[model samples]
Target: MARDPNEPMPDGSGCALQEPFALQVLGADMEPEFPDKCVVIIEPTEFCRSGMYVFAEVEGVRWFRQYLRDEQGRERLVALNDIFPAIELNGLDWKVLGVIIQRNIRRKIKTYEYADGPSNQPHGSINAVDITAS
Candidate 1:
């Protein structure tokens, strides 16, 4: 049997259910952008727009992908790497868990901020900064 995606996974950290959290990228599915083992900060929100790197649940499986909503109103979860096929979300049971706001790659922090309205870009304005210095 598959686990219910709505139910939160236990981390034993005792973090608040609705608070922001960090997750380590486990695969190259989102590679070139979010490389394997990179840490990402997720901001829990009920409002998720297009062009955001989002943590979502689809068909009982949790996924981290770029959320896309086309002009025809079709929705999809796309991997940054082309090796993975995009997940079309027309009739599937899916929900956005949160939007990735920051990514840490070897002490370099890349911040992602979405515009107030819809966007055609895959990722909105990004600002990268090195935090290696104290």
Candidate 2:
């Protein structure tokens, strides 16, 4: 694929570098864990482990998948959804752009609560604010 000279290439072949950015998940390739429209935080310099979620570029195409090693000790990309076939990376030119640190699943309302300790809350009751109620 042709890349714009002004825009930085994700392959790291160009001098331009990219910073941390947000990418919205699409399709069922990474369903359940990374549902559709869920925003993922990508840190360009984050270290990627064997089982960590990563943003990788393969064959000039970008994808969100789990990084894993195959039985033959070869690196491969596995989709959370079993329906999608895993990509064996024996001959592909791939680059790990970043590791996904966090994800924001959109819900009705975001809530949180603070308490002194576990004793401050009632048994089997959550201390979180119910601001969703109007």
Candidate 3:
């Protein structure tokens, strides 16, 4: 496991001992899927595979991005939103801290339901419903 460069020396506070952790998505780099403020569950011990969502260290900086292999078989980090440029892996000191296994959407999910009773109803209008409970 790669230690955080800015982390203070362990003083037996036991802050490091824990299970799967959660991180809040903070930018538009991973939008449409991992929207801003959404909580993601990270499993540190899970085996990471290609195209997995992971938090990694790149040149002493922690970055949350999707892990992928480029056409030339190079490991690269990509942002879901195309507005951000992909980070290419090269001489940087990088390590996968964990893979995202689940996401807790803090925003509302829009769902459509039939407004009228469905007894073989034809062309019924749909009512928009927002499911916000997490």
Candidate 4:
């Protein structure tokens, strides 16, 4: 997909030197974690800190999951949903498409589709995706 030449990325992120990736969201598999209809900005060059929300491609599928590293010094990918779908580093070669740097959400009282979307709503905060690099 082509971004408008005048369109600006958050924090002065530019598309000139970077190849922008566009992926259609499938469903609520990653909600409370990310807004349902919001466009996810996957910043590949940004340093992915532990606990940061990340966009990854695994087994030919693209998804947004919390980049997790357990105490064993292992890199793992986990879904925020209670189901907690986990991807271990042993066999699956997870590709970090980029880090979820920004999201656009539209709601009157703020409702999320992930585990963190809203408490009254609990299922967590749509803006609760952790981005702090380790």
Candidate 5:
């Protein structure tokens, strides 16, 4: 993993571990998805990739959307769920936050068995199983 150019040492007291950036989503800009207050994670040396979520800083505003690459490898950050707003010329000085690995929702998923019931059961499915937990 790449470390940030400027980061203080972490002691028992505490450490500024991961770099997190907060973005205030606006207007159908990224609607249908990437709602407002979508906290994005930005890791050091993590460049932008087409069709990936990135926190792009343009002018004085920051935007979160799925980045798209053109034939020439040029990029345009676009929202999959929205089309009214389109981002163009994606090579500008944009701060790329880490890709959105998951989403936050209030809905609960129903399953037949508890998570530990079966290995192939859906109810008790576990993501990123811990070595210690197993």
Candidate 6:
């Protein structure tokens, strides 16, 4: 069967770089939740809110971190692990490239979906679950 030209390939082959892309987690910065070597699918979007795992570019350098907005509306990029210091976006030039929507650990697929309405969780928080293949 022929594949769709617009669909993103697992290996990123023949797909537009601007579209949703898969990237391998390289460090323990986002450990526990997103372990090293795990593959994450990033959906390009400009409408990122608080508490979303996002791929962003800061001062010309790209990073994968959790987007955060404090009560006062101050924004920052934080690592899941406490060891890594947070990147405050108060006066920095930053742009969110995409939000992580899926993660693949080993052969298990874990999906991260945003909540629809108001909830106890933070705004734009994700609900992650393991998706079993039948």
Best by TM-score: 6
lDDT, candidate 6, 31-93, per-residue tens? 888999999999987778788899999999999999888779899999989999999999998
TM-score of each: 0.79, 0.64, 0.65, 0.57, 0.50, 0.81
lDDT of 1 by residue, 16-129 (tens): 867889999999999998999999999987568777889999988999998888889999989999999999999999988899989998888877777667544445433445
Between which residue pairs do clashes occur in model 6?
A: none
RMSD values for the candidates in order, in angstroms, are 6.9, 10.5, 12.2, 10.1, 11.3, 6.5
* Candidate 4 lDDT score relative to the true structure: 0.57
* Model 5 backbone overlap count: 3
Per-residue lDDT of model 2, residues 13-100, tens digit only: 5433556677888888888767888777777753555666789999999988887754478888889889999899888888888877
Q: RMSD of candidate 6 to the true fold?
A: 6.5
- lDDT per residue for candidate 4 within 1-134, as digits (tens), equals 98777966666355653665534445676766454565665566533545666787778886687766555778777776656567775578567767665554442222222332213422123344434333
> In model 5, what lDDT does residue 120 have?
40
Give per-residue lDDT, candidate 4, residue 116: 29
Show where candidate 2 strays beyond 4 Å: 1-18, 107-134
Report the Cα lDDT for residue 92, model 5: 65
Per-residue CA lDDT of candidate 5, range 1-134, in tens?
97675985554223343444433444555544445444333432256545555666666676666666655767676765655566776556665545444343232221111123234422123342112221
Cα displacement (angstroms), candidate 6, residue 10, comes to 25
Q: Name the runs in model 1 displaced over 4 angstroms.
A: 1-15, 118-134
lDDT (CA) for every model shown? 0.84, 0.68, 0.69, 0.57, 0.48, 0.87
The list of candidate 5 runs beyond 4 A from truth reads 1-27, 35-45, 107-134
Clashing residue pairs in all predictions, respectively, total: 0, 0, 0, 17, 3, 0
Q: Which stretches of candidate 4 lie over 4 Å from their true place?
A: 1-24, 107-134
| Predicted candidate 1, C-alpha RMSD | 6.9
Question: Ten-residue segment with the worst summed lDDT in candidate 4?
Answer: 109-118
Give the winner by lDDT: 6
* Decoy 6 TM-score against native: 0.81
Clashes of 4: 17
C-alpha RMSD between model 3 and the true structure: 12.2
